[model samples]
Target: MGVRMRLTTVETVHEEGSWLFTVRDQYGADEEVVLVPCEDGVEAWINRCTHESQRLDTGRGAAMRDGQIICPKHGSMFDSCTGYCDNGEAAETTLPSVDVTVEDGTVYLTDDEVSYLRDGGIDEDEDEDGGPSSTSHLSF
Candidate 1:
């Protein structure tokens, strides 16, 4: 349902800086991909909230709560380290997560993604059935 965009190369982001990439699927929806540098190499995550499809702001979503991103809308928290969704109260489901690997200092978004059953087969995170890593779910 979303349009997948061509993966571009970014060469200036630092350790604490974030690189944003947009992936447009076939449905015209542009999924926001963010590459966050972690102590353990690099991590890839979709910038969307698991609840109401809110675009998760990299700055506000993830706060320094022992290290994780919290959804400002519903207070749903997700571990940026692993893209695990644990809203403030208890851990519920997770959003769509993309596999990331860095080579030659360039971060690439792998083809690895799970499909959400509701979106005619768009990849959803393993934990959240209908929720997408980004707006991929809403696009469809």
Candidate 2:
């Protein structure tokens, strides 16, 4: 399990929508995770779409319509609670889920593998901004 970092209180997050949040990994790297409201509790997953590898919440947050995370590119809909994509082009595929725990109204990532989708799967080379780039190859 990774360090239990506080994400937010349950009161602040609503059940009808999703929130795109970032957390640092064990190596102190920023990882993008989406916190979605579910029936049992809040669920977390990597922000990348399973079909085309695009950020699920890119332009206007996640496209959460009719209880599904609809992929903007291919319109693949994933269940917010189970990370199951049973519709659209990527029907058999599922989004990568992040380990999370909620205690005392606080949410946290509970594994050392937590991380944002790194550009090129993660490289040590620093970009011009003096920081690692989060860009990743997207197949269309």
Candidate 3:
């Protein structure tokens, strides 16, 4: 296991509907990860729909119903705990997941392929400023 970097809290994930965070992949590209409440705890997945590469959470929150995350583009519902999509255009597909662990009510980024960058998606000025913004609506 690699170093676990702090992401967010379980309380915040529940209170905010969802939590979005930025991470730098092994290839040095920024990727967004969304944390949603699950039956057990919070589960983190790459913030895009599998079928169309559409963002699941568009700076607000991913539409969820009955413990499933809804794909806004195609209405595919993904199991929040398993990342599995059993119907719609994304049927039988699973959203790419970003490994995370909850400890002491806090969430940490544990995926070896990525490193925590900031608490939001790719910022508008990220390329210009060389980093993410300190605050964003998508963040906790």
* Steric collisions counted per model: 21, 4, 0
Listed in order, each prediction's TM-score against the native is 0.57, 0.70, 0.85
Better of 1 and 3 by TM-score: 3
Deviation from native of the Cα of residue 52 in model 1, angstroms: 1.5
Per-candidate RMSD, Å: 10.5, 7.5, 6.8
Report the CA-based lDDT of candidate 3 relative to the real structure.
Answer: 0.83
lDDT of 1: 0.51
Ranking by lDDT: 3, 2, 1
Higher-TM-score candidate among 1 and 2?
2
| Model 1 residue 11 lDDT score | 45
lDDT (10s digit) by residue, model 3, range 20-136: 889989999899999999965799999988988877887767788889998766778899999999998889999989899898999888999998888877853424643322222
Clashes of 1: 21
Kindly give the stretch of ten consecutive residues in candidate 3 with the minimal lDDT sum: 131-140
Candidate 2, position 71, lDDT: 70
**Model 1's TM-score against the true structure:** 0.57
TM-score of 2: 0.70
